[model samples]
Target: MSDTTSPARLVVLISGNGTNLQALLDACQDVSLAAQVVAVVSNRRDAYGLVRAQQAGVPTAYHPLKPYTDSGRTREDYDEDLAAIVSGFQPDLIVCAGWMQVLTPVFISRFADRLINLHPALPGLFPGTHAIERAFTAFQQGEIESSGAMVHFVVPAVDAGPVLDQIVVPILPHDQLDDFEERMHVHERILLVRAVQKWLTERASLPAV
Candidate 1:
């Protein structure tokens, strides 16, 4: 276990361009943020996040998502490799910034409460890929009240863990998926920074940040 009173050390996992990774880097520049990103991990070698992480002086690595999925490899095989890579850093928090793989039980059990993620929709709403499109469709059908982002503990079930924090964005009449997603993402960046800072600056009461 990490020394709760000490600073938080994070390992960010990403699959895509890692805009959020940039946000985290920005937050760390603040003296009071109380956390450090020691490593940025990606499932794709060519992910832009890798470049950003490297430029930001964070160690980086790639593990293709396919090798860990339902591609004939045993869960333990994938979990062993995953565990070695992640555990090597001794991360206090594993931020699934945009990590695209669904972690296996072995990985989840080891990390369990230590892992956190940001999802694109308010919980109990859009829960998968193309969340913006899903929310737009639902809003068009007059069903969705709102949509936004949330930070939650990573569990076996995707985006179905206890929420650490969240910000709700209304489904506006003029909202396009692209525009809405962009705006909501801005909120996501600020909100996540706040959450991490709160956890770090305050006493060692881990309250889901």
Candidate 2:
């Protein structure tokens, strides 16, 4: 935990559009929040989130897999290098928002308890990609009445981490996928910002590491 005089630093990772990242950036402006994003990292060079981070004056780094793979770097090696870049920031927390890669265990173990990820489904419902679509399909098939979003610790297993927070959104029978998706995105953004603030507050109450 950090002293009240110093804000907890954050390193955010993103793979695509960063609506969630933007939310955190906005939340940090409150001045009362106990955290600030120190850097943003992306695996894709063309990710628009880099632009968003730049606009917010946050330093950004790109670690695309193609270059490393082209040079015959193993997945574990790529993750290790990425971990080093993140460590250089010395962040108290690392957040993965829309980051698409299946990170190696090396990276997950490096951050451990301090790493968190945002997933577009309730815990244990959908674990991998296209969670929103899967939920919609289930709803259409009458398998569920609602779907949700969750934020959880990043563990060795994909999307199989200890859940920190979640919020449900009902799938009305008449709801269209596009509208439902937009609603989920909105809920995700709110939940992510609130969850990060709460997590930092809880950590701040603990004894220093």
Candidate 3:
């Protein structure tokens, strides 16, 4: 845990455009958040999140899993190496903003209570990739009326971890996929920041070990 009087250190992981990563970067600028994104790591070298981190003057790392797969190494091996990279930052928290990979227990146990993720669906629904498209399709099929986004603890079970915060996003009758996606993203940014603030407040309230 970080000292209550100091800004909490954060390490963010991303795999793509990193709009959520940008949100965290922006939030950290506000003193009330009491956190600093010390590092950003991406599984793909081309992930624009790394560029965002660089623009913010935060350190960046690219830890791709291709070499591991090419060498016939296990997922655990890749996770172990990824954990090592993250450990170097000594983050008080690790946020998987847009990280696409399903982390193994090796990495999960290493960070354990400190790791969290932002998923583009309500808890227990559309648990994996393509959540937005899946939800929109479900709505079109008359199977569901709305979907949501959440920030949650990153357990080994995909996005099934305990949710910290969530918000329902209604699927309007005439909405297009892109329109719904954009609206959900706006809500997601707000929810992610709120969840981090809530987590930090709770952690600060705990009695010191």
Candidate 4:
């Protein structure tokens, strides 16, 4: 837990555009959130999230897995190095916002309860990537009436950790995939911010060790 007098530091990881990361950065502008993003890390050098971080004047790092694989190192090695980089920021919370990599225990156990992720579907629904598209397909087939997004703890299982917050998005009678996806993104941004706030609140309430 962070000192109550200081805003909790966050290190966000992303792989793509990082709209969710943008949301977090935007929300942190409100002092009441009691959190600030200290750094943003991405596995892809081309990721726009790094640009977002730079625009916000937050430090950024690009840690790609290829360098490890190219040198006969394993994914665990990459994860270890990534963890080391994140540790330098001394983050109170680590957020995987659309970070495409499935973390190994090397990283997961290092952060333990301090890590969370945003998924495009509800808890126990779409567990892996492309969740929005999968959920939309399910809805189109009449197998489901709605899809949702959630922020949850990150464990070894992909997107199966306990949920912190979620919001269901109904599939309307005449919804296209693109439109539905756009709406889902909007809801996701809000849910992610709320989840971070909730986590910060809960952490603050915990008795200091």
TM-score of each predicted structure versus truth: 0.90, 0.96, 0.98, 0.97
Error of model 3, residue 99, in angstroms: 0.2
The global C-alpha lDDT for each of the candidates, from Candidate 1 onward, is 0.81, 0.91, 0.93, 0.92
- Ranking the candidates on lDDT from highest down gives 3, 4, 2, 1
What is residue 122's positional error in candidate 4, in angstroms? 0.8
Where is model 3 more than 4 Å wrong at Cα? none
Ranking by TM-score: 3, 4, 2, 1
Which runs of model 2 end up more than 4 angstroms from their true locations?
1-4
**TM-score of predicted structure 1:** 0.90
Using alpha carbons, what is the TM-score of model 4?
0.97
Error of 4 at 11 (Å): 0.1
Candidate 4 stretches with Cα past 4 Å from truth are none
**Per-residue lDDT of candidate 1, residues 78-196 (tens digit):** 76788789899999888888787777778888887778888888877778677778887888899886788888888878889888888888777898877777888888887787766
